[model samples]
Target: MKWVTYEAGAGERTGILDGETVRGLAPGTTLAGLLAAGALVEAGDDARRAPTEVLGTDDVRLLAPLPRPVSIRDGLCFLDHLRGCHRALGRDESLHPAWSENPGFYFANADAIVGPYDDVPVAPGSTMFDLELEVAAVVGTGGRDLDPRRAEEHIVGYTFYNDWTARDHQLRDMAQGIGMGKSKDSAITLGPALVTVDELEPFRRDGRLAFEVSASVGDRELTRGSLATMDWTFGELLAYVSRGADLTPGAVVGSGTVPGGCLLEHVDTPDLAAFTGWLQPGDVVSLRGEGLGETRQTVRPARPVIPLRDGA
Candidate 1:
């Protein structure tokens, strides 16, 4: 069943879409809630209760389907793209060899997420910006030291994510061997909707998922690839990531950017001109997969204004 966190008239709440009409669920609602309340079965029992009712595809304000992810872990799993980048930049791919042992990932601030339709703010004093199209999995059960073989059991579902990067800040941080610069204010965009594991399991085998991913900026198609192209499986990532840390329900784990996934792969100039030039204000980015629905967000300049001084 498809689930979503939405804001209609009242504040943000969870709901199941029935055609063009959305039936509200409780706040802090979860997949377990739907299963416990028998809502999932009810929705499935009748063909009419499908989530297509509350809003048409165009009308829904799709928030990140999982509102309160406990933690967000993102991994670098694209070998072909990584090798291409190393070759293009004339860097040593051997230094960052494909995971011979296990998966590796970094933590992302879950609260930093924004909705699909929200305007991404291009922060002031920023000239270099880039976008990354990625696939993210939501965790359902909490576990520790999880075996790679049982990793799939912890996943709740999957969603689309755009990991926006501030190149200037990122470079500065990278020079220092850190990632803080690439991971700051409004740096992540998620949602459109969340498709449950039950709805998407047919596309997976053992613990690896296979799905086609494609992205477009305005009228130009930028990237197209498949999840099968990934070097490490989600199970490997889960097992590696959860080694000592707790993997909680609602945690999000993203598969790093795909090949030609960002302008960085296609552009050759030193200033990254061709890359940042296309994402002018008002440009719309759309991402889609076979079972997971499409997510679109428009780029807009950060609003200009300053706060008044407290005793002025």
Candidate 2:
């Protein structure tokens, strides 16, 4: 089942993607609301009645499947990405083996999420803006101290996530013992549709992520890795997250950068500034995965504001 939130003649409403049209589920209801009400499974199955007016897929604008999540935490689930990034930055010391013992993640701004068609706005003075190819599970059932064995039950569906990054800000923040919050602000994008967890059973592969993740900037392919490479399973991550907090409906847990997904893994900062493949205005980034669908965003650089200072 594919669920979406879209804007139509009536207004922004929740719907099911059926063929080339979006069939409305109910007015003023969103995917998040449906999840909270525990009506998603039932709502999607029974949304066949005619809408006030059916919107052709082209006539409507798709929003993030869950427009407003309670929280967003993107995790570094693939070792190849970590190694590649560190190596690109001239690091030789290997990460401690203990670092991979448990699933790890960084909390992101939930309010920063945009939809598939929205423009990705680059932060001003960002020397390197990159995209992190990811797939995220949307929470359906809320729980505390969730068992790893039962974590699957809490997942409602999956969506493609583009974790946009401002590399200049990220590295600077890290140098001062501050977090990377500024570098990751106001740019995460997701959507097109949300595919239910049941729809992905064939690709489960004994419960570890196994979907192929792909990304491209215009005509150039940047990544061709698979979720099969994840060092940690969603169950383990969820269990770890739930240890001290409650997992709630509408929360998003993201798989971090797949191998070779971002510029940070391919080029050093000085070299990247001169690289044409690094995202610039009008560059379209297309991200896709097996069964998870695709999301494309056109990059738009922040308008430059020349700094003014009084003559010394």
Candidate 3:
């Protein structure tokens, strides 16, 4: 089932997207609440048996499936993306041996998430605005030190994630040998809907979801890749994440950028100002997957950046 959270009248509501209509669940129902209660599947079944209300597509405005997830962890599962990005940065193009030893990830801004159709503002002082096409799994059960073989049972569903980035800021911050910093905290988009694991059975190949994803900037198609190309599985990634930490419900685990999923991997240099294809205000960026839904966002001007230190 495709679950969604949308705006209705003066309040928010949760529903199941069935074809062109929406089968409304109880008022104030949220994906986060359902997952935290360990009743996502039960709630879905109940809604199917008796929908409280039904509305057409034009009746409601969709929001992120879980507007404020508990936490967000983005994993680097695809080696091609890393290799391509390394070459673009004038670094070694060969795969790093450390990358093969672990399914590593970085913590992201959970408060920065937006809906599928929301307008994303370019980061202030950023000239190289870019987007990373990814797939993320939402946790349904809380666990610690989870076994990789049984981690799949903790996942509730999958959703599309557009990990928007300020390329210039990211490069500068990472150059200091620290984290990626807040370069990606400006805006991260998720949803259209949260598709349950069972719903994706048709796309499963060799026990992995093998869906193809593509992204476009307005009329021009930028890149396309497959999720099955990931070197590590979601289970292994989640297992590593829960090594000594708690993997709680409503937490999101991203599968990182797919191979060739972002413009950073395709560009030769970090000089976006000299590049004509950089995203501009009013540009529409759309991403679509074979099974997961599409995420379409419009770029907007950035807000003024505040100085962090004493006046220079």
Candidate 4:
């Protein structure tokens, strides 16, 4: 079953997307609340019945499945991506042992989220703007020290994720042991629809998922890669993140950037060097994966952030 959220007169409201129509669900009940109640199955079952109201997809402006996630964790799980990046850069030993030994990830601001059809507000002073094509899983319930074997049970659904990056700030800040949250938080996208595991299980192998992810700018398809190429499975990623913390309901996790999914990984490639510069104002970007669907947005800078105090 596929779930969605969209703009309503009262504000964002939860609903189910069946074919060309969106059926509104219970009042004041957000998708997050359904997951927390461990009622996703029941909720979806009820939604299939005649809903409160039904509207065509074009009649409503779609928002992220969860407009504001409780937390966001993105991971680097693909090995081919790392190897390709190293080869392109003429470097050796780029594949560190720890990558295979343990899963690694970084925290992103949940508030960075924007709707699927909304314009992306680029962070100011971000010259190396890039987009990472990926898919994300939303947690259904809280779990601490989650067993990798059982992590799948906690996942509520999956959605397409566009992890917008300000590469300049990312590189500079991490060079000094700091995070680039200031830049990363400026742009992020999720949605189209949240497909439950049952609806997407056909794409799974063992515990890993395989999806053809593709991204395009305007009409040109610049990125294409397989999601199954990852070295770490989503189950492993969840277990690692839950080591000393909880994977709470409403929490979200990303599959990291897929191979060739972003410009940074192609930095030394001839094609990347010949590209028409970084993302500019008003460029339309589209990202799509197998069951996760697609999210397209036009680029725009978030209103200028002016500091009240002068720096030395």
Deviation of model 4 at 38, angstroms:
1.1
Query: Which candidate has the highest lDDT of all?
Result: 3
Regions of candidate 1 where Cα sits further than 4 Å from its true position: 27-60, 87-90, 93-95, 182-185, 205-207, 270-278, 303-312
Tens-digit per-residue lDDT, 1-312, candidate 3: 999998878578888998988888888788889888888878888888899888897888889988999999999998888888887777888875788899879999999989999999999988888999899998888899999899988888899999999988997888887887867899888898999898988988986888898888898887888778889999999999999999999999999999888878878665545665567899999999977888888999988878888792
lDDT of 2 by residue, 1-312 (tens): 888889876777888888888888667778888889999877776677555456789989999988788998888888778888778777763887866787778899988989988988787778678898888888899998989898878998889988999887888878988666678985888887888988888887766757787898888888898787788778777888888899899899997888888878878553545555567989999988788778888988786846666652
Per-candidate local distance difference test: 0.70, 0.82, 0.87, 0.81
TM-score of structure candidate 3: 0.96
For candidate 3, the lDDT comes to 0.87
Clashing pairs in 3: none
Name the TM-score of candidate 2: 0.93
Candidate closest to the true structure, highest TM-score = 3
Off by over 4 Å in 2: 49-52, 268-276, 305-312
- TM per candidate comes to 0.84, 0.93, 0.96, 0.92
- How would you encode candidate 1's per-residue C-alpha lDDT over 1-312 as one tens digit per residue? 667777765567666655555665545555445544445546444424443234454454667776556678888777666665565455665644336566656777776788877778765445666678898887777789999888878776788878877655666777898665543445587777777788887888645677788888888888998888888877778888898988877678988888878756666654444454536678888887888777777888855535468664
**Which lDDT value does model 3 have at 81?**
85
RMSD of each: 4.3, 2.3, 1.5, 2.3
lDDT of 4 by residue, 196-284 (tens): 88888898875677768898878888788876788887888899999999889989999887888876666655344454556878889
